[model samples]
Target: MTRDDLAGMLGEQTTACGPARDALMAGGDFVVWDGPVPAGQLARTYRMRLRRTQRRGQPTLALAATVDRLLEAEEELLRIGQIVAADSSWTFMLFLNAAATEVLACTGVARIGTCPWTWCA
Candidate 1:
Protein backbone atom coordinates (compact mmCIF):
# COMPACT_ATOMS: atom_id res chain seq x y z
CA MET A 1 0.00 0.00 0.00
CA THR A 2 1.04 3.58 -0.51
CA ARG A 3 1.91 6.00 2.23
CA ASP A 4 -1.47 7.64 1.86
CA ASP A 5 -3.10 4.26 2.20
CA LEU A 6 -1.09 3.57 5.31
CA ALA A 7 -2.07 6.94 6.70
CA GLY A 8 -5.69 6.05 6.19
CA MET A 9 -5.10 2.63 7.73
CA LEU A 10 -3.66 4.08 10.93
CA GLY A 11 -5.59 7.33 10.83
CA GLU A 12 -2.38 9.36 10.92
CA GLN A 13 0.42 10.45 8.66
CA THR A 14 3.66 8.44 8.58
CA THR A 15 7.03 10.13 8.69
CA ALA A 16 10.34 8.49 7.87
CA CYS A 17 13.57 9.67 9.48
CA GLY A 18 15.42 9.51 6.19
CA PRO A 19 14.43 8.67 2.63
CA ALA A 20 12.54 5.51 3.48
CA ARG A 21 9.26 7.03 2.46
CA ASP A 22 10.76 8.63 -0.60
CA ALA A 23 12.40 5.38 -1.62
CA LEU A 24 9.18 3.52 -1.19
CA MET A 25 7.40 6.12 -3.25
CA ALA A 26 9.92 5.52 -5.98
CA GLY A 27 8.97 1.81 -5.86
CA GLY A 28 10.63 -1.53 -4.90
CA ASP A 29 10.95 -0.51 -1.26
CA PHE A 30 7.45 -1.46 -0.22
CA VAL A 31 7.37 -4.96 -1.66
CA VAL A 32 5.79 -7.66 0.50
CA TRP A 33 7.93 -10.56 1.66
CA ASP A 34 6.21 -13.85 2.33
CA GLY A 35 7.66 -17.04 3.78
CA PRO A 36 6.81 -20.26 5.60
CA VAL A 37 8.00 -19.30 9.03
CA PRO A 38 5.36 -16.66 9.80
CA ALA A 39 2.73 -17.49 7.23
CA GLY A 40 2.23 -13.80 6.62
CA GLN A 41 3.44 -10.90 4.47
CA LEU A 42 5.46 -7.79 5.29
CA ALA A 43 6.79 -4.70 3.66
CA ARG A 44 10.50 -4.94 2.88
CA THR A 45 11.64 -1.59 4.32
CA TYR A 46 9.55 1.50 4.71
CA ARG A 47 10.75 4.29 6.89
CA MET A 48 8.00 6.42 8.39
CA ARG A 49 7.24 8.80 11.19
CA LEU A 50 3.95 9.35 13.02
CA ARG A 51 3.97 12.20 15.44
CA ARG A 52 1.41 13.36 17.99
CA THR A 53 2.07 16.07 20.53
CA GLN A 54 1.83 15.16 24.18
CA ARG A 55 -0.44 17.01 26.54
CA ARG A 56 1.61 19.21 28.85
CA GLY A 57 4.78 17.10 28.78
CA GLN A 58 2.87 13.86 28.62
CA PRO A 59 4.48 11.32 26.31
CA THR A 60 3.04 10.84 22.86
CA LEU A 61 2.06 7.36 21.75
CA ALA A 62 2.26 5.75 18.33
CA LEU A 63 2.48 2.16 17.07
CA ALA A 64 3.29 -0.25 14.26
CA ALA A 65 0.64 -2.88 13.83
CA THR A 66 1.86 -6.47 13.97
CA VAL A 67 -0.22 -7.27 10.95
CA ASP A 68 1.53 -4.49 9.11
CA ARG A 69 4.92 -6.08 9.73
CA LEU A 70 3.88 -9.68 10.00
CA LEU A 71 6.25 -10.90 7.31
CA GLU A 72 9.30 -8.94 8.37
CA ALA A 73 12.38 -10.42 9.99
CA GLU A 74 12.18 -10.81 13.74
CA GLU A 75 14.62 -7.99 14.39
CA GLU A 76 13.01 -5.78 11.79
CA LEU A 77 9.62 -6.44 13.28
CA LEU A 78 10.85 -5.38 16.68
CA ARG A 79 12.63 -2.43 15.17
CA ILE A 80 9.49 -1.06 13.53
CA GLY A 81 7.44 -1.41 16.70
CA GLN A 82 10.09 0.25 18.84
CA ILE A 83 10.71 3.01 16.34
CA VAL A 84 7.06 3.99 16.23
CA ALA A 85 6.52 3.64 19.96
CA ALA A 86 9.77 5.26 21.06
CA ASP A 87 9.60 7.99 18.47
CA SER A 88 6.39 9.11 20.08
CA SER A 89 8.01 8.88 23.52
CA TRP A 90 6.52 5.46 24.22
CA THR A 91 3.00 6.74 23.81
CA PHE A 92 2.34 5.11 20.47
CA MET A 93 1.86 1.59 21.70
CA LEU A 94 -0.78 1.05 24.35
CA PHE A 95 -1.11 -2.76 24.00
CA LEU A 96 -4.88 -2.83 23.57
CA ASN A 97 -6.69 -5.85 22.13
CA ALA A 98 -3.38 -7.68 22.01
CA ALA A 99 -2.72 -5.85 18.79
CA ALA A 100 0.49 -4.06 17.98
CA THR A 101 -1.63 -1.43 16.30
CA GLU A 102 -4.34 -1.76 18.91
CA VAL A 103 -2.57 0.94 20.89
CA LEU A 104 -3.65 1.55 24.44
CA ALA A 105 -5.83 4.56 25.28
CA CYS A 106 -6.44 5.18 21.61
CA THR A 107 -8.27 1.90 21.10
CA GLY A 108 -10.46 0.58 23.88
CA VAL A 109 -9.80 -3.05 22.94
CA ALA A 110 -8.44 -5.08 25.83
CA ARG A 111 -5.18 -6.87 25.27
CA ILE A 112 -5.31 -10.62 25.34
CA GLY A 113 -1.92 -12.37 25.51
CA THR A 114 1.42 -10.91 26.53
CA CYS A 115 2.92 -11.54 23.14
CA PRO A 116 3.79 -8.13 21.69
CA TRP A 117 4.83 -9.32 18.29
CA THR A 118 1.84 -11.05 16.75
CA TRP A 119 -1.59 -11.07 18.38
CA CYS A 120 -4.04 -8.85 16.51
CA ALA A 121 -3.52 -10.59 13.22
Candidate 2:
Protein backbone atom coordinates (compact mmCIF):
# COMPACT_ATOMS: atom_id res chain seq x y z
CA MET A 1 0.00 0.00 0.00
CA THR A 2 0.98 3.65 -0.42
CA ARG A 3 2.20 5.85 2.41
CA ASP A 4 -1.06 7.75 2.72
CA ASP A 5 -2.97 4.52 2.65
CA LEU A 6 -0.73 3.14 5.36
CA ALA A 7 -1.11 6.30 7.39
CA GLY A 8 -4.87 5.99 7.24
CA MET A 9 -4.61 2.35 8.17
CA LEU A 10 -2.37 3.25 11.06
CA GLY A 11 -4.79 5.91 12.15
CA GLU A 12 -7.53 3.37 12.20
CA GLN A 13 -5.34 0.85 14.00
CA THR A 14 -4.45 2.93 17.03
CA THR A 15 -6.30 0.57 19.31
CA ALA A 16 -4.59 -2.43 17.78
CA CYS A 17 -1.05 -1.26 18.53
CA GLY A 18 -1.20 2.21 19.91
CA PRO A 19 2.27 2.52 21.34
CA ALA A 20 3.96 1.14 18.29
CA ARG A 21 1.76 3.07 15.92
CA ASP A 22 2.28 6.23 17.89
CA ALA A 23 6.00 5.65 17.96
CA LEU A 24 6.07 5.28 14.19
CA MET A 25 4.03 8.41 13.67
CA ALA A 26 6.27 10.26 16.10
CA GLY A 27 9.25 9.18 14.05
CA GLY A 28 8.13 11.48 11.17
CA ASP A 29 10.04 9.58 8.51
CA PHE A 30 8.86 6.15 7.59
CA VAL A 31 7.43 4.31 4.60
CA VAL A 32 5.14 1.36 4.36
CA TRP A 33 5.49 -1.55 2.00
CA ASP A 34 3.98 -4.97 1.61
CA GLY A 35 7.22 -6.82 2.31
CA PRO A 36 10.81 -6.23 3.20
CA VAL A 37 12.30 -9.61 2.40
CA PRO A 38 13.60 -10.76 -0.95
CA ALA A 39 13.98 -7.03 -1.59
CA GLY A 40 10.70 -6.77 -3.56
CA GLN A 41 7.68 -8.90 -2.92
CA LEU A 42 4.07 -8.43 -1.85
CA ALA A 43 2.49 -9.99 1.20
CA ARG A 44 -0.44 -9.70 3.55
CA THR A 45 1.87 -8.11 6.09
CA TYR A 46 3.21 -4.57 6.21
CA ARG A 47 6.81 -3.43 6.43
CA MET A 48 8.10 -0.07 7.49
CA ARG A 49 11.16 1.74 6.23
CA LEU A 50 12.85 4.29 8.44
CA ARG A 51 15.79 6.23 7.14
CA ARG A 52 18.45 7.96 9.21
CA THR A 53 17.54 11.51 8.25
CA GLN A 54 20.10 13.23 10.41
CA ARG A 55 22.87 14.78 8.41
CA ARG A 56 26.40 13.44 8.73
CA GLY A 57 28.53 14.58 11.69
CA GLN A 58 25.36 15.43 13.58
CA PRO A 59 26.32 12.94 16.29
CA THR A 60 23.97 9.96 16.28
CA LEU A 61 26.12 8.08 18.78
CA ALA A 62 23.72 8.64 21.63
CA LEU A 63 20.77 7.48 19.56
CA ALA A 64 22.72 4.46 18.45
CA ALA A 65 23.53 3.56 22.03
CA THR A 66 19.91 3.77 23.06
CA VAL A 67 18.85 1.56 20.18
CA ASP A 68 21.31 -1.09 21.27
CA ARG A 69 19.97 -1.03 24.79
CA LEU A 70 16.33 -1.30 23.64
CA LEU A 71 17.15 -4.16 21.33
CA GLU A 72 18.69 -6.03 24.22
CA ALA A 73 15.92 -5.22 26.68
CA GLU A 74 12.92 -5.84 24.40
CA GLU A 75 13.91 -9.13 22.91
CA GLU A 76 10.59 -10.77 23.66
CA LEU A 77 8.49 -7.92 22.36
CA LEU A 78 10.44 -7.98 19.14
CA ARG A 79 10.53 -11.72 18.67
CA ILE A 80 8.56 -13.30 15.81
CA GLY A 81 8.13 -16.76 14.42
CA GLN A 82 10.36 -17.86 11.57
CA ILE A 83 7.44 -17.95 9.15
CA VAL A 84 6.38 -14.41 9.90
CA ALA A 85 9.94 -13.13 9.90
CA ALA A 86 10.55 -14.79 6.58
CA ASP A 87 7.35 -13.47 5.06
CA SER A 88 7.73 -9.87 6.21
CA SER A 89 11.49 -9.70 5.93
CA TRP A 90 11.39 -6.49 8.01
CA THR A 91 13.19 -7.93 11.02
CA PHE A 92 15.93 -9.27 8.83
CA MET A 93 16.06 -6.15 6.67
CA LEU A 94 16.23 -3.94 9.73
CA PHE A 95 19.06 -6.05 11.09
CA LEU A 96 20.78 -6.00 7.72
CA ASN A 97 20.32 -2.29 7.11
CA ALA A 98 23.81 -1.74 8.51
CA ALA A 99 24.05 1.93 7.64
CA ALA A 100 20.74 2.85 9.27
CA THR A 101 21.44 0.53 12.21
CA GLU A 102 24.84 2.15 12.65
CA VAL A 103 23.22 5.44 13.54
CA LEU A 104 20.19 4.02 15.37
CA ALA A 105 21.96 1.15 17.13
CA CYS A 106 21.03 2.44 20.55
CA THR A 107 17.96 4.63 20.29
CA GLY A 108 14.17 4.39 20.51
CA VAL A 109 14.30 4.24 16.74
CA ALA A 110 15.10 0.55 16.81
CA ARG A 111 11.99 -0.06 18.81
CA ILE A 112 10.07 0.91 15.70
CA GLY A 113 10.60 -2.61 14.51
CA THR A 114 9.58 -4.12 17.81
CA CYS A 115 6.53 -1.92 18.20
CA PRO A 116 4.38 -3.85 15.75
CA TRP A 117 3.78 -6.97 17.76
CA THR A 118 0.57 -7.70 15.88
CA TRP A 119 2.75 -9.07 13.14
CA CYS A 120 3.88 -11.93 15.29
CA ALA A 121 2.31 -15.35 14.66
Candidate 3:
Protein backbone atom coordinates (compact mmCIF):
# COMPACT_ATOMS: atom_id res chain seq x y z
CA MET A 1 0.00 0.00 0.00
CA THR A 2 1.00 3.61 -0.53
CA ARG A 3 2.30 5.75 2.35
CA ASP A 4 -0.78 7.86 2.42
CA ASP A 5 -2.87 4.71 2.38
CA LEU A 6 -1.03 3.45 5.43
CA ALA A 7 -1.44 6.80 7.12
CA GLY A 8 -5.13 6.69 6.37
CA MET A 9 -5.33 3.33 8.04
CA LEU A 10 -3.45 4.63 11.08
CA GLY A 11 -5.87 7.54 10.99
CA GLU A 12 -5.49 10.21 13.68
CA GLN A 13 -5.37 7.95 16.68
CA THR A 14 -2.41 7.95 19.06
CA THR A 15 -1.39 4.60 20.42
CA ALA A 16 -0.20 4.20 23.99
CA CYS A 17 2.45 1.69 23.00
CA GLY A 18 5.25 2.15 20.50
CA PRO A 19 5.31 5.16 18.17
CA ALA A 20 2.31 7.29 17.52
CA ARG A 21 0.59 7.34 14.15
CA ASP A 22 2.16 10.77 13.65
CA ALA A 23 5.54 9.09 13.12
CA LEU A 24 4.24 7.44 9.96
CA MET A 25 2.44 10.63 9.04
CA ALA A 26 5.64 12.61 9.43
CA GLY A 27 7.17 10.72 6.48
CA GLY A 28 10.10 8.39 5.94
CA ASP A 29 11.22 5.43 3.88
CA PHE A 30 8.66 2.66 3.90
CA VAL A 31 9.00 -0.93 2.79
CA VAL A 32 6.84 -3.96 3.37
CA TRP A 33 7.74 -7.62 3.14
CA ASP A 34 4.94 -9.91 2.02
CA GLY A 35 4.28 -12.61 4.55
CA PRO A 36 2.24 -15.15 6.27
CA VAL A 37 5.73 -15.91 7.55
CA PRO A 38 5.01 -19.49 8.62
CA ALA A 39 3.49 -19.58 12.10
CA GLY A 40 5.90 -18.29 14.77
CA GLN A 41 8.61 -17.01 12.51
CA LEU A 42 7.80 -13.35 12.91
CA ALA A 43 8.23 -13.37 16.67
CA ARG A 44 11.14 -15.72 16.41
CA THR A 45 13.00 -13.41 14.06
CA TYR A 46 12.42 -10.41 16.28
CA ARG A 47 13.48 -12.36 19.33
CA MET A 48 16.70 -13.40 17.69
CA ARG A 49 17.41 -9.84 16.59
CA LEU A 50 16.66 -8.50 20.04
CA ARG A 51 18.99 -11.02 21.58
CA ARG A 52 21.74 -10.04 19.20
CA THR A 53 21.23 -6.39 20.07
CA GLN A 54 21.40 -7.22 23.74
CA ARG A 55 24.70 -8.99 23.23
CA ARG A 56 26.10 -5.79 21.79
CA GLY A 57 24.88 -3.70 24.77
CA GLN A 58 22.29 -1.74 22.84
CA PRO A 59 19.10 -0.86 24.67
CA THR A 60 16.43 -3.36 23.60
CA LEU A 61 13.61 -2.87 26.04
CA ALA A 62 11.28 -1.31 23.53
CA LEU A 63 11.98 -3.87 20.88
CA ALA A 64 11.70 -6.67 23.39
CA ALA A 65 8.30 -5.38 24.48
CA THR A 66 7.26 -5.10 20.89
CA VAL A 67 8.33 -8.67 20.29
CA ASP A 68 6.22 -9.78 23.18
CA ARG A 69 3.26 -8.01 21.67
CA LEU A 70 3.99 -9.63 18.35
CA LEU A 71 3.95 -13.01 20.02
CA GLU A 72 0.56 -12.24 21.51
CA ALA A 73 -0.91 -11.23 18.19
CA GLU A 74 1.24 -13.29 15.87
CA GLU A 75 -1.59 -15.09 14.23
CA GLU A 76 -3.31 -11.96 13.01
CA LEU A 77 -0.40 -10.35 11.27
CA LEU A 78 0.21 -11.33 7.66
CA ARG A 79 2.93 -8.86 6.71
CA ILE A 80 5.60 -6.68 8.25
CA GLY A 81 7.22 -3.34 7.43
CA GLN A 82 9.05 -0.36 8.84
CA ILE A 83 9.04 3.43 8.67
CA VAL A 84 12.35 5.09 9.30
CA ALA A 85 12.43 8.76 10.14
CA ALA A 86 13.80 11.08 7.52
CA ASP A 87 16.57 12.08 9.90
CA SER A 88 17.05 8.44 10.86
CA SER A 89 16.53 9.24 14.51
CA TRP A 90 13.94 6.57 15.12
CA THR A 91 11.89 3.81 13.51
CA PHE A 92 8.55 2.17 13.84
CA MET A 93 8.01 -1.46 12.99
CA LEU A 94 4.55 -2.07 11.62
CA PHE A 95 2.71 -5.35 11.80
CA LEU A 96 -0.31 -5.81 9.64
CA ASN A 97 -1.96 -7.88 7.01
CA ALA A 98 -1.08 -7.62 3.33
CA ALA A 99 -4.46 -6.18 2.41
CA ALA A 100 -3.76 -3.16 4.68
CA THR A 101 -7.08 -3.46 6.41
CA GLU A 102 -5.61 -3.04 9.91
CA VAL A 103 -2.43 -2.38 11.84
CA LEU A 104 -2.19 -5.03 14.50
CA ALA A 105 0.74 -3.49 16.33
CA CYS A 106 3.67 -1.08 16.08
CA THR A 107 6.79 -0.27 18.08
CA GLY A 108 9.16 2.64 17.92
CA VAL A 109 12.80 2.40 18.90
CA ALA A 110 15.42 5.10 18.95
CA ARG A 111 18.21 4.82 16.43
CA ILE A 112 20.84 5.94 18.90
CA GLY A 113 23.50 3.66 17.45
CA THR A 114 23.76 1.16 14.66
CA CYS A 115 20.43 -0.51 14.18
CA PRO A 116 20.43 -4.28 13.79
CA TRP A 117 17.98 -4.02 10.93
CA THR A 118 19.78 -2.54 7.96
CA TRP A 119 16.59 -1.19 6.48
CA CYS A 120 16.21 1.06 9.52
CA ALA A 121 19.63 2.53 9.03
Best candidate according to lDDT: 3
Better of 2 and 3 by TM-score: 3
Model 2, residue 10: distance off in Å is 2.1
lDDT of 1: 0.25
Q: Write the per-residue lDDT of candidate 3 for residues 1-121, one digit (tens) a residue.
A: 7877777666322241234356666777877777656325778887877776676665432566667767876666467777877777777777776565776656665675667363354
For model 1, how does the per-residue alpha-carbon lDDT over 23-74 read when each residue is reduced to its tens digit? 2233412222222222131222211221111112222222233234333333
Count of steric clashes across candidates, in order: 11, 8, 0
How high is the lDDT of residue 3 in model 3? 76
lDDT of each: 0.25, 0.26, 0.63
TM-score of each: 0.20, 0.22, 0.68
Between prediction 1 and prediction 3, the one with superior lDDT is 3
Candidate 3: deviation at residue 85, Å? Answer: 0.2
Give candidate 2's error at residue 78 in angstroms. 19
